[model samples]
Target: MQIAIDGPAGAGKSTIAKMIAADYGIIYLDTGAMYRCIAHRVLLQGDDFSDTEKIIKLAQEAEIRFEGEKVFCNGEDVTESIRTPLVSLHTSDVACIKEVRELLVAQQKKIAGDQSVIMDGRDIGSVVLPEAEYKFFLDADVTERAIRRKKELDAKGIEKELASIKQEIQQRDDNDRNRVEGPLVQVEDAIVVDTTGKSIDEVCAAIKKYIDEVRA
Candidate 1:
C-alpha cells in the first residue's frame, strides 16, 4: 500500500508521515527534501535561483537519497544543510519549475516501486501519488503553522522574527497554490485533516484510525 500525505509548510505532514510509516513498517519518503537538495546544489554553485534552466539541470543531474532521517545529495550528507532558510526559500522556487517537478516526481515514484511507502510533500496526493491507497491533506491556521515553523527554526538556532516567518510562510502558500507545475492542492478523495490546535499524536491517531478502518 502507498500512502500520500500532502500539506503546506509546518502542517506536520513530515512528522505524521514518519510516524505512520514507522508504525506500519514501511519506508517514508520526504519529497520536499528532493527539491531542497537541488536548491542546495544551486546555492553551492552560486547560481541564480531564477535561472530555471540551470535549476532543472542541477535537479536532473544531482543524486538524491534518504536513509532514515539523513538526506544525501550527490553522495554528500546534506541532512542539515538543506534545512537552511535560504534553501527553504529556493526549494519552493525549484519545485515550481515544470522540468524540476517532472524529474523529481519520476525519482520519487521509482523509489516507491511496489513497496509499502508513506510519502509527504506539497503535491504528493495531487500529482506524485494520485493512486495511493490512502491520501491525506493536512492543514493548520496561518498563525499556528507559523508558530510550528518558528519552533523548528529555533531548534536549529536559526532566529527570525515571528512576523517575518509568518509572512514567508504565507508567501510560500501563495506560491505553492499558484505554481504552474503540480500546484499544491487537496484532491477530492483525500482526507483533509485540520491540524490547528492538535497534537502530533492526535493527528497521527486520527489518520491511523482511518487506515485501520480501511484495512478492516
Candidate 2:
C-alpha cells in the first residue's frame, strides 16, 4: 500500500504522516527532508541559491539516506541540521530547480517501490507517487499553519516572530504552486482534508476512516 500526503508546510502533514506510518508498520519517507538536505549542502558550500550549476551538481552527488527519522546527507547525519530556520528558508529555492526535483523524485520513487510506504511533501501525489493506493491533500488556514510553525521553532529555542513565519509560509506557497517542475498540486482523486481547527488525532481518525472502509 502507498499513501501520498501533499500539503503546504505546517499543515501537520509530517507529523500525521509519521503517525500513519507507525500505525501501519510501513516506511515514513520524508520527501521534504530530501530537498532540505540539498539546501543544507548548498548552505555549507557557501549558501548560494543562484548557483544552479553548483546546486545541481550537489544534487547529483548527494547521498541522502533515512535510518528511522534521522536523515543523512552524503556521509554526515543532518537530521537536526537541516531543520534550522536558515535551511528551512532556503529549501524551496533548491526545490524549484527542475534538475534537483527530478533527482530527488527518482530517489523517492525507488524508496516507495514494493513496500508499504507513507510519503509526504509538496508534490508526492502529483509526481512522486501518482499510483498510490491512497492520496490526501491536507490544508489549513495560513495563520493557523504559521502559528504551528512558530511553536515548533520556539520549542527549538529559535525565536521567530509569528508575522515573519506567516510571510515565509505565503512566499513558499507561491513558489511551490507556481514552480515549473513537480509543482505542488492536489490531484482530482485525492481526498481533501482541511485541518484548520482540528486536532491531530481528529484529523488522523478522519483520514483512517476512509482508508479503513476501503480495506475492509
Candidate 3:
C-alpha cells in the first residue's frame, strides 16, 4: 500500500513517514529533498532563481537519487549540502516552477508503482499521490513548528534566531500555498493530525492506529 504524508515545514512529516516506512519495511521517499538537490545544483552553477528555463533544465539534467538516508546528485553525496539555509530558500523558489514539479512528480509516481512506499512532502497527498491507500496531513502551530525547526538547525550547527526562523517558515508556507504548480493543500480524504504539543511517538502511534484499522 502507498502512504502519502503531506505537511508544511517542521511539522514532523519526514520523521513520521520514516518511522512508518521502517516499521513496515517499505520504501521511504523524501520528495522535498529532490527539490533541494536541484536548488543546490542551481546554486553551485551560480544561476539566477528567476531563470525558470535554466532551473527547469538543471532539474531535468541533474541525476538525483536516494541511497539509504543519503541524497546523491550526479554521483556526489550532497545530503548535508542540500540542507543549508541557502538551499532551503532556493528550494522554495525551484519547487514553484511548473516544469520542476512535473518532472519530480513523474519520478515519484514511477518509483511508487506496485510498491509499498511511504512518501512525505508539501504536496504528496494533494498532488503526488492522491490515490494512496493511506493519507495524512500533519500540522502544528507556527511557534511550535519554529521551535522544532530551530532545534533541527541547531543540531546541524546552523544557528538562527527563533523569530527569524518563524518568519522564514511563514514565508515558505505562503509560497507553498500560493504556488501555481502543485500548491500545498490538505486533501479532503486525508486524516489531519494536529501535532502542536504531541511527541513524535504519539504522532506515529496515531497514524499507525489508523493504518492498523484499515488493514484489519
Candidate 4:
C-alpha cells in the first residue's frame, strides 16, 4: 500500500509521514529530498540553477539512496549536505521541471509498488501515487508554518530573519502551486487536515482515525 501525503512547507508532512511509516512498518520516502539532492548537486557542480537541461542531465546520472534517515548520492553521504540554505532556496525550481519530476516520480512509484510505503512531497498524491490507498493534504496558516519552520531551522543552528523565512515559504508555496507539472494540489479523494495549532499527537490521531475508517 502507498500513502501519499502532499502539503506546503512546515505543515508537518515530513514529521507525520515518518510516524505513519513507522507505525505501518513501511519504508518512508522523502521525495522532497530527491529534488533537494539535485539542487545540491547543481550547486556543487558550479552549474547555474537556470540551466535546466544540465540539471536534468545531472539528475539522470545521479544515484540517490535512502537508508532509513540517511541519504546517499553517488556513493557519497549527503544527508546533511543537501539541507543547506542554498539548496533549500532553489529546490522548488528543480522540483518544477517536468523531466525532473517524471524521473523522481517514476522512482518513487517503483519503490511504493514494492513495499508498504509512506511518501511525502508536493506531487505525491496527484502524480506519483495517484492510485495510493490513502492520501492526505496537510496544511496550516502561513504564519504558523513560518514559525514552525523557524523552530526547525533554529534547532539546526541555521539562523534567519522571520520576515525572510516567511517570504521564502510564500515563494515556495506560489511556485509549487503554480507549476505546470503535477503542481501541489489536493487529490480528489484526499483528506485535508489543518494543523495550525494542533499538537503532533492530535494531528496523528486524526490521521490514524481516517486510516482506520478507510481500511475498514
Cα TM-score per model:
0.98, 0.98, 0.98, 0.97
Q: lDDT per residue, candidate 2, 1-216, as tens digits? A: 999999998899999999988888999999999999999999999988999999999999999999999899888999999998888889999999999999999889998889889999999999999999899999999999999999999998999999999999998899889989888899998999999999999999988899999899
Could you tell which candidate, 2 or 4, scores higher by TM-score?
2
Instruction: Tell me, by lDDT, which candidate is best.
Output: 2
What candidate 1 gets wrong by more than 4 Å, as runs, is none
Report the lDDT tens digits of candidate 4 across residue range 104-179: 8888888887688889998888888888889999999999998988887899999988889889999999998999
Q: Is candidate 1 or candidate 4 better by lDDT?
A: 1
Clashing residue pairs in candidate 4 (N, C-alpha, C atoms within 3 angstroms)? none
lDDT by residue (tens digit), candidate 1, 1-216: 999999899899999999998899999999998988998999998959878888878887898888899999989999999988788877888888888888899999898898999999988887888899999999999999989988999998999889988998899999999999999899999999999999999999999999999999
Superposed model 4: Cα runs more than 4 Å off: none
The residue pairs found clashing in candidate 1 are none
**All models, RMSD in angstroms:** 0.8, 0.7, 0.8, 1.0
Backbone clashes in model 2, listed as residue pairs: none
RMSD of 4: 1.0
Per-residue lDDT of candidate 3, residues 63-179 (tens digit): 989999999999999999998878887788999998999999999999998989999998888788888999999999999999998998999999899999999889999998898
In order, the Cα lDDT scores of the candidates are: 0.91, 0.93, 0.92, 0.89
